[model samples]
Target chain A: MNVLPRRQFIGQCCAAVGATGMMSALSALRATAAAASIPSGNNLPGTEADVASDYRALVCIFLNGGNDASNLIVPYDASGYAAYASARTALALPQSTLLPILPKTSDGRSFALHPSTGELKNLFEGGKLAILANVGTLVEPTTVAQYKAQSVKLPPQLFSHNDQQAQWQSSIPDQPFKTGWGGRMADLVNSLNTNSAVSMSMTLNGVNSFQVGNLISQLSVQPASASSPKGGPVAFARTTGGNNPNRYQTQKDLFTSPQSNLFSSAFGTLSSNAIGNSDALAAALAATGTIATSFPDTSLGNQLKSIAYLISAAGTLKLKRQVFFARIGGWDTHADQVEADVSLGAHAGLLQQVSQAMNAFYNATIELGCANQVTTFTASDFGRTFTSNGDGSDHGWGGHHLVLGGAVKGGDIYGRMPSPVVNGPDDTGLGRWIPTTSVDEYGATLARWFGVSDTNLPVAFPNIGRFAKPNLGFLG
Target chain B: MKPATIYLAVAAGFLLLLLVLRPDAGVATDPRSPRIAAPPAPPASAAPALAASPVASEERSPLADGLNAPAGTVDEDLRIVATLIEVFRSNFPRDGNPTGSNAEITAALTGRNRLRLALVPPDHPALNARGELCDRWGTPFFFHSESRVQTEIRSAGPDRKHWTEDDVVTKQ
Candidate 1:
């Protein structure tokens, strides 16, 4: 399928451009050819092999460092804020500075968000964002008494960063895991995609734990280079488009050469996939017109913009379902959480970027008429300790999360925030909370909506059976 | 898009291809393997003074030893807590009888020519305990009597959380 356009394109470029752009095109073609020759079969059993008209995608915005969710979603009620401030002391945000929000259920418990999340608040009010509260990794439904008694099973290395991050992505806190919940889900639904060569898992962040599965390794796209032709998002071996036909032909011959060496052949396959996906995706994005909505000129903003571009080209990519992963670090605010103004600081800046990028990306989806089909959620290494260490907070367990989409049941809070009282049942000393809702239940909810059947929910997330509700009802 | 840029990209890819396709490259060797080392275990004996521990001398500010200390946030904090401990130690003699309440010492840290309004991090260790005197990590310096006379001042140190290997202290 790829043999003709690749060779013909190189020939045309060489002829028309007088050797200019021919070499890059030739090498690119060779890479794509290898990429298209993927060793298939990570598909789920009983697949219909039917292309689906309805498209849905899940975008996971992973905050690399442990985010202080306590400060993210705050309480505005007098008694609640008093308790929260008393527990957190100097770490608590000023009550007046908070952006107050009206939740769907007016049960008298008033809530507010970090002031930087103004755009997110707008999204919530506009019925496009839902808050998932007090969610964390859990092996089973656990209680305070059971947690204290050492009676119930707990996630391995409870407070450690690496362990908890794996638990969140893998949904298997008890032991070592290979396949992430995203990759597993992609394997199941990928059969719906017409382009069998392109995997469903994609990440802007180089390699990540969440997008690796037995059947689905991420189609890891390089960040679009400013110098690249048409903001090239593909990671090519070298710059593309030049007058060096001899060098191009040599490189192309080497990449396209039939190999007998096992290791060489394997490397060829990987390079092939990378080059192929890059060629296909880059061309599609270049062909696509400019987006109307403006994305902030930040790293996260650019990544989200790239994701928006890809989602808009869904038909070109022949995608029925896709799982996207992106990361924005510097969330580990162990010190200097805020500034002298109290409203601005490291955490606030990150949150602001998140709000702006998410809002813009949401609008882009609408621009593509795929707004209802895409849902984006935020994840972190873990939540910070509820109580401040003085300047900032340390790592903690349970934290609130945000899920946004047109299809989501917004303006509501799912799960419950444990009492802010340090060592008050919810706290294990310095305010490290035991999670109320497990990651299993959370992933199952998203997976179910992504087209995984009720029976196949456990296949996507192994520990879903331990929790009561498979569907959290956020993605309505 | 330009002639020169495309050449550069192809050249970059060529260099990359050469690197990955190195003849001596080892098979199945991944440099990104996770290194999961266990944290050092907590000390078994809960000695109040913590004097027997090694850090008693290393963490002391030059001011505590009557020498001009280097200026740094951590050193300044250690000096602050050490100053408070010295002040509190003078109030309570070695006889194990309490001379002043925890509040008096906290108020003393607030007064002039002493520890100024040096705000600690929000959830400092002493946030739950009495005194508000905090260390560099914004964690409260752990100040309590072994009995009533000897005072122990501890900072959660770099980790910012108490009771870890990274903890620093005044007077061991």
Candidate 2:
């Protein structure tokens, strides 16, 4: 062997230990023999080298509680408004308050967004956003007649909160919860992130099904708060530099020490990995510094701001493809959804929060020169009733959603817009519109844009083939 | 004018002053006391205007007398329960607390906490052994929360089983 100096030998040993620690921290995400069996399929029209060189991210903003979609994307034409106003008597917003939009191609009807969603309207007019109408969880495509006749399978527990939320996140409504579509997508494309130490999936909201995967688990990060304004990895208390430097060493030793019991051994390994991961992430984020773009100080704004920071550090973290999850609650508007003015209340406040935060996030992406690379989409448990129940609406089936980015074919409404009439052709009963487009179709489109191939689309969304259009063409 | 007529007018004025001064002169002194007759129901047009007003009304429904005196239809009983729950929710607007389950709601309404809002008396017949608000059919009413404030009250109707055609439902 070649002779080496004492200093060189010590440096090499330290490097070896550090590399081992990083590998152990990300042990779950390593592409082992078992993980190699997962179907990645062939990437879309691109070589592996091309895909590895590029970057893209999918951000999911899950609005907790069933949103009232009837008032969200309203009909603004005279006759359409007449029907909407007739159905939603006291809860209807004034026609003058509605912010009208001219779709690229309309289905013989004009539309306006909720008065509170002015930013969304701006995005629509600027050709950065597109609306997908009447999308919801479905076993397969079913019409009002089939729904009434009970001739087709339906999503289990249609109106309940927890069940519907799981169904929407999983995108596999027919089967019991196995994994979220986001998680599955991450698993398939995780190879793109060649040298990443952290999981490709990160969540601002703690512990969601959307980011739970088989190989790569979600990493929960805190939003910018008063204590830690520039939020990063949630570190353990006093685990770093302190007066008791020996204490940190002792704790690390205890965690990494071998154990006889299986449970203790597992716990020790997890704790050691957590410490290593947190330190690695904190260092990466500190190196990336901060972006100059200003974000709002609200709950959702803080989450999106944190996400923007994380995206800025994607290169430092060695991530090529990433998925993020954020959530905001208080959308369950059973009563007090609107006030006497019909333009302000709980629902309006929530919508404004969503609009402002989303707008800020999109701007931040543009500032980072990744506007065309990142796509943000909105989802909720389900839609609310079209017919108002005195002051608010009840749980319903289908609802509208917003998809926006620089690459979107925006300023247009896709899918079939249901008739506003209660008990109409689209309505099964009580204005619960049967979904014309399934969640599988919507997710498949996003997966395709995120670089998932046609063959691997089924791996992410098993029910995608049941739907006619896998690519909705909203994304360019 | 005669001096006697003037004295009589002064005496009537003094009596009216006494009537106005005495707080208990017009209405029943005790809130728990039975009223001779129920107040007329407010019109449909007035409902929205009075939506945020106080829950205490001059009208006495079967709910005030306890479920033992329930002589109304299932639909009427459900409405009464829903109105009571609505009043409870209005007082405590905090989301997800004391609204998750029937027992929690019962605890809040029956003065088990610091607020001490005796919306439903502890010994009322509407409450079962478990302290849940029961329907006229002697079954606990299912409280489904659409949100923190809005709840759907369902009573297992005549058959005393839930999710059936005869079940009575009301959203508040």
Candidate 3:
């Protein structure tokens, strides 16, 4: 592998910080010291050559942009199917293109998927994937009339992307919050670990609002590669003083300087932490062994592959708990959503890639013997409207999401499926359905099953108390 | 007293003390840590009125407090525009993509108190795709995009002195 240059790495850091403007002279000195102190081989806590492994992790795949779910998981019953077809218009997937439906006895209901998701069908039938329908941000249990009359509060900027995305991740639609439900859940269970080499939260997609914690920050890693400050060892080693080592010494001196302000101190601390975490991650990666599972080579696939690689290395990291964040975009299909194959194109194509990769990842987890210990779930900003906006659907509230793993009560749909009519009882003026189940309820159930105590549930999900029941009964 | 009998009696007493102390020593604390003092709980009565004025507590959210300035002050307007800069840098296809580290960015912003640089015109190269002006915490201000120029304006007009919350605030 080609090594990243030291000067280039410093330049990138400079630019990143430069986005707001250049850092002070003192900050540069501290950063250099932190960079030099990065841990070397065998220095981390868990990688002592050999160790036994038994741990579990959850990987969350967030599909950004309000994913049009009406076309993703369709109603298969005769009446419901017809209503969906009528409302969706140009956006509807023909019955012929849908993945085969698995009829369930509980609600006398059956569902189909866009033909692109044939791989997903196999997993569902094999009892790996469970669907949750009509879920969105809610402060409390609300009705359409109540929503229209403003009797109860709703999430801020209901149809906007950034607002709703933060709301979904934080479970606090009332404002923009950094602590996601996942990060908060990590906060509760993070202290249980014996190893301090790795953090509870890791993100392949980069720094996100969802992975932030009050005290602990998420570690950002590259997909399928070692993570550092961009440029290689030499770049990191090159400092500002006369000799290579001089820069590091200068930086250390600056951080420890009594004259330094609180801001300077904080900058020194964070930069040092970043370098420390990166070095630890590199060491952990070096000590990992390969797994037999093969993931698809797509972007999402590469991300899952990294996640799998990390899980395979869990022994070396000495982690009892971990949360991985992965994301796939391009779901904002405004026009010509049909694929080149016609039946297997656009939105359908994206779903197929999602299903195939997930199924493969699930199988890999099983092969690794951590299948039951690992749970994978999906989340999105909001669901698209039931009615098609010419070629695609517009942004709407309350779309369906999926959860997959050996531990999930799979092979069925949870939550009330909204009527697929243009102006049904659940509709709020337009075709957007009011969510019967809050995002808080859905997240709380998962967090509960993941080992978060009932007492800590409110902290992970503040709005959970506003709902009648916290758990959605998805975990088996 | 017989020496062997005295020793056995002392050992028995020590064992009893150990057994009595062990249970209390091993007792579990509340399995969950007490909540970090969050801002006082939202009022039950106020819950119903959230729809009327939606953003009553937007400033208090962790994202707002940790990442950007609270959204009302001139500092906030500049910070909002900087968000667009962050987004543009993240979205740039060929310049080598990075997710933009929030911590590092935050440090960079705080290091140089450039929190009120929004008075500068949009034409400056510093406002370009990769080098956009950020708030004190390195949050790139959010703005609507129209080609290269981000459509967000910090001030209402040339004066920028009279801008209010009701003024047109661009969304990314």
Which candidate has the highest DockQ of all? 1
Task: Pick the lDDT winner.
Answer: 2
Candidate 1, B23-49: lDDT as tens digits: 422111121222211222223321111
Q: Write the per-residue lDDT of candidate 3 for residues A217-334, one digit (tens) a residue.
A: 4554566534421211112343543345666657545645654578777756644544444455555565455556677767787778777767765665666788888889877664
User: What DockQ does every candidate get?
Assistant: 0.03, 0.02, 0.02
Q: Which stretches of candidate 2 lie over 4 Å from their true place?
A: A1-53, A239-246, B1-172
- Chain A: TM-score in each model: 0.87, 0.88, 0.83
Give the per-residue lDDT of model 1 (tens digit) for A26-68: 3323323433343232232111122234989999999877788
Interface RMSD of each: 16.5, 15.7, 13.3
Error of 3 at A102 (Å): 2.4
What's model 2's lDDT at B95? 23
Cα error of candidate 1 at position B108, Å: 35
Candidate 1 off by > 4 Å: A1-53, A228-233, A239-245, A260-262, A269-273, B1-172
Q: Give the range where candidate 2 chain B is weakest over 10 consecutive residues by summed lDDT.
A: B45-54
